[model samples]
Target: MAKAFASQGDLTEKEISFTEIGEGLYAFTAEGDPNSGVIIGDDSVMIVEAQATPRLARKVIDCVRSVTDKPISHVVLTHYHAVRVLGASAFGASQVVMSEKARSMVVERGQEDWDSEFDRFPRLFQGHEEIPGLTWPTTTFEGRMSIYLGNRRVDLMQPGRAHTAGDIVVYVPDQNVMFTGDIVEYHSACYCGDGHFHDWPRTLEAIRRFDLDAIAPGRGDALVGRDMVNAALDLTGDFIRSTYRPAARVALRGGSLKDAWDAVRAECDPKFSDYAIYEHCLPFNVARAYDEARDIDTPRIWTAQRDKDMWEALQG
Candidate 1:
């Protein structure tokens, strides 16, 4: 290979922040690393997203302990991404829940994704040895489901296909706050390797229609007000559009993958170069955008070998 993946060189640890976005609702963010959300109810707690490893999940546990001693009754996964679901065992929650489609994805490509992501981002998997195996959900829902932690209604819904076909958002209606997975990122780059480029903007609009007061985004900081929530939504939509437009144009015109890459860069680099993981996500985003534009509805599974081949073809 000519050079390593961008995430391979990102070994520096980011500063962690546990910010309260709403009453009993917190966002555990590590700069541009994967973020998690916490919701405390009358008797128990619910976790929105788990980190990549048990060692990483402990940080979220520590933060949860700081504010409340209630037991974690449920762990709600936003999607089937390895970085977000592999750390579930550490929570020791009685109920681990996911969308039915997401569970199917876990059965299909979970192991491949875990291997792919582990190789692509080594620093995120600090405790790979502790992982028993692939994580599975104890409960699965079709489209939407609501759980009550002692009268606190928590709604989990899949607005539409965006980051993935099964992506869901965790909404606490009482607080008017939502925990959007990779569907909505704050200042970080959206990893579109498993995305629906054409359906993403409509998903963004679906989220925006709620007029949320606050949101704990997939990456970056906690949005604590309507203004910040809207800003994140708008910025995330812009990121998706900026990445897909040029690549789609290139692909429809019968351009090569390298040609699509350059076209995407010319359009995205000026606006998104400084975004976290921008360089790391660009190639895969371009390739996926190109594929989707060429009428590939479902994203190809990203195995470790596929990751290498793609990186070598684009980055080598």
Candidate 2:
């Protein structure tokens, strides 16, 4: 397993690092890129969050092979982001599982998301053509599902909507370990383009009920030990609060989107400027925050054109 880093070129072409986070559990992370999790069960393996392309996924396969010979039976999507689910076919898993809501989201906005994300972060989708098309779940569950990997149990539950309408967490109770997709990040700026800001903190509180000793976050390094785990959660919570609060305040004051964006940057940059992806996420985060604060519960779809327009409007 390798350490995650920040890549500057095509994301699909970037190198990925797979690190063991617990007994038979691994975190596949790229340099400040989206992450995937692997759980090697007694008889088979479960991969959570597929990368963006088959070519990139092969790198994850190679890492998994280095650790075990078990077949990968399932690929679980924590949500329906193109960067996270598009590379699923590469795993050859018998079943691709996702929340029912996630499947709906894929059908509704997957193509638009794919185009938007690829345009925004070209470095994360290095081999863009290698994608077999949008990944769909062969199996979908509502609320929660408990999967048995031989003697081990993996609980896939949607605590609440935070990062997206279909966010989920993979809980390994026996190991006291959890894989929180983009719901919680460590030293990484969270992208909130499709988030429910008001519901996000409550979602975090739901996640805290797990009493996890270790956490494989969506981005950044794996958290080990309770102290580090708390620190990661706290940092993530603070980041979300600091980002959304000011943006919401400005929006409520009838300020323009640019004003809200500038207000948020003024409040958050001093504290979180050094966090990974801070510059990358701020514009999108502010946009979503403004929408949510204005009583838009559902995030507006982000087409490639809309993405560029928003970036130029907020950044330029």
Q: Which regions in candidate 1 have their CA more than 4 angstroms from the true location?
A: none
lDDT of 1 by residue, 181-228 (tens): 999998899999999999999999999999999999999999988899
Tens-digit lDDT string for candidate 2 (1-316): 3212112233354356777778999988776678889999999999998988887778889889999999999999999999899889899999999999999999999999998888766766878887878899999998889999999999999999999999999999888999999999988899899999999988888888777888989998888888888888888889889989999999998999999988998999998988777877888899999999999999999898987787778756
Give the whole-model CA lDDT for all candidates, comma-separated. 0.93, 0.87
**Residue-level error in angstroms, candidate 1, position 28:** 0.3
**Residue 242, candidate 2: alpha-carbon lDDT:** 95
Q: Which pairs clash inside model 1?
A: none
The candidate scoring highest on lDDT is: 1
**Clash count, one per candidate:** 0, 11
